[model samples]
Target: MAGCGFDDLPLTRPGPPLNAWGLYGEGDEYGRLNLITAQTVQAGLREAKEGITINLNLPLDTMPLNPTRAPLRHEIIHRTHCNDDHVSFNTQGSTQWDGFRHYPYLNYPEKQQYIYYGGMTSDEARDRSNHRCGIQNYAKKPISGRAHLLDIASFLERHQRSPLSYFDASTPIDLETLESCAAESRVVFKPGDILIVRTGWTEAFFGISEEERQSLPHRQKRGSCGVSSDPEVLRWHWENGIAAVASDAVAYEAYPSVNSPSIHETFLAGWGMPIGELFDLRELAAECKRLKRWTFFFTSMPLYVNGGIASPPNAQAVL
Candidate 1:
């Protein structure tokens, strides 16, 4: 395939896989790396003036799953006597992000890496007590920034096109349709900006009966379909210097891709991007449409566990 000029194809080769944070791409011409040393909670707090800060967290129990696939557990002791004078009921669970010690790819740790600064394993990393970027990373951060919402569902609705009752789990995304949605929205992106997308899938999940949701598999091998994002769009985000990308879908990239899930591979492995998935953008989308402003403060706190693989972001938008 390299002989076919395929070497230049971004997704053709194996790169780093997605971690708890996001993809980290290859080095650049000037030896610069993708998504290296992003702004941490300390940095964010230094910039905030103050206003009404809205929380984007949807209580863990309210979240679709009991616990994300991340490695962690909680023990509940119904009856436990600490000393008889006081009976102590104990419950233990890992809150926020999964440390690098939580997961090891190819049996390796993220020691000296971005999130994992000191060591790799939990023991080596000092019992995973570090909170470098943990939920605290978002503390004191300003929720006041330029935010834009791309409502793909409304774009489809205007054309009288409706997503499948249960989006075709096997269909590849239509790139053209995605471009059309952007055009219809009259949205413009700037460098170092935050981007948000709405697909209305989150609502569908909520609307379904509990029994129905329980009956469905966690994720289907054949994925959902719609205007899937193309490489050019992904490149646009990078070239335009987009700081972050948020989506209300299960996975940001379109399912059943024609290009081998290039978005995930590139963003996670190649660029070290920070993705906000399973975000609650409905309120923000509605406000953007109502005001026709399409801009606001986009903020989120990712799990800051060192060497962690993934974390549920406490995302929010302040308009």
Candidate 2:
């Protein structure tokens, strides 16, 4: 762990493709978040110009079961004077972030190592004293940094001849297209910056009728536009020193992940990286368009649900 530079990270890939298990340390729970240092916070502070804060959280009930994972159930408890509402929902029900415990490094054939990120044994994940990764770590010390929004949907609509679909889960948002959008937005990419991408999946889902939306089957094998599930994209994430990358889609990467695994497996399971999903970027994106800027001071606060796998990101962007 001593004298380990960023270049010397991972030491060696315990799992194939690329694994940053030992990059932070044998006991590291917060992976790339370690990059969000004082410098990054200062950089974020510099971007807060208008003091206009855009709420990135979508309504909890909006497509609560879009990913078809779990439906949110609620009940009301009426007291003598006041009534209390009880809500039961999955961490990913709505606008939320995926914790390290949510997925595992399952590409490998080894049963023990494939159980979770960093090749962690099952016991390590459930052990007491919280030795393994926990979402509360981020809750305690939230990730504050310069946020760059790569509004993919907005850009696609401008160039493509035909109307862009809500999402092309089957199609990977190729790097060329991604960079073009950034160039168009004139947003500078920086290390430790949090990138929020919008593919218009959430907007498309909410645009439907309530009855029609509810009638749709769960977990449908449909496509959503996201970062290309390619090796180069992963390389870009690591080389750029990104703290985390989020999207307005269900999964940050293309559904079915094109060919190779995307950030879902490698980021959360391999590198212990975190990801935000299903944020409301309509207002933020509109503001960016008016101001001619895509960068902001981004902040997210998670609930301190100890040992919880995921939580709703009370996220916002200040510009």
Candidate 3:
């Protein structure tokens, strides 16, 4: 079946709410990613006219942002006058792409029953024997396509003459604000385009003192400012044919979501769309402003671990 409108969701029989289970195909791991066809890639390549490349990943050592995750560890091994390095860290310690298995819908809240994309269960995702709906699926065909940036922070400062006072949980970038930003920037949506939003979360995180950084995880209210989890946001993403969405915020959507079935569950599990978080978009945003262009060629390759739930996005943008 062709990609249906957002109103025609819940394509599969007895499926969860706002799902696109059978839109791509049964047992299909790649959800919106399938939209990045060869033609789409070729079109993206055309955006590399200036021969400039910008790295979109934050340093691996800039991790342990979440207290639950282990800190990055690096060790050096010396042998025969040669040196080798061994590294170990959480795939999601820094910038990362949340895979299909990363988030699952709570189908039966009473019994705590969870369901992943394409009707895969949590147990199925945990079983390493089968690599269904894993990050490796993305590795098989790396995500590469034209990307559009909605510079929300910059837009507000330039046009509205009022910038965000704080980058925290209290702040929410609503759909209307995002539309206004895009309109002010003259960005036109296109099928198979990777949508990137800059919310200034990363900049705020790094701007504080080292003492404050150390106290982040221990804080009782550790919420991030990001896109709103309103159903209308999902409708906009589906209607625009966005293959994936990335942002500098810790969570692509406001952390501790105000709505049920957060963007993580709906996008990652329902639509099979990847969600990138903690991306370093400061440099990219500066370049976009310098060039006065919001579109670029975006590419990302995740780790090839079978049954992997998430991985750092080795991403780049060419213009």
Which is the leading candidate under TM-score?
3
Q: Model 3: which residue pairs collide? A: none
After aligning candidate 2 to the native by TM-score, how far in Å is the CA of 67 from where it should be? 6.8
Error of 2 at 136 (Å): 0.6
The candidates, ranked best first by TM-score, are: 3, 2, 1
**lDDT per residue as tens, model 3, 1-319:** 6748888887875777788998877778999899999989998999888989999999999956789999889999999899999999998899999999888887645326898998888889889887999999889978998998999888777776555534344466788988998887788888899999998878888899999889888878787777888989878988998999999988888887888678988999889999999999999999999999988999998999998989998999999
Question: Candidate 2 residues 1-319, lDDT tens each?
Answer: 4334445544554554566777777778788788888999999989999999999998776656455567678899999999999998887888898988887656666464555666666666776556457788888769788999998888888896343455434556877777788889887777789988888777787788888667544435665656787877777777667888888877788776755456688788776778888888999999998998999999999878877788899999999
- What are the runs in model 2 whose C-alpha is more than 4 Å off? 1-10, 66-68, 110-113, 123-131, 161-164, 167-169
- Model 3 stretches astray by more than 4 angstroms: 107-112, 161-168
Q: List the global CA lDDT of all models.
A: 0.46, 0.77, 0.87
Highest-scoring model, lDDT: 3
Candidate 2, residue 140: how far the Cα is off, in Å: 1.7
Ten-residue stretch with the least lDDT total in model 1: 27-36
- C-alpha RMSD between model 2 and the true structure: 2.7
Worst 10 residues of 2 by lDDT: 161-170
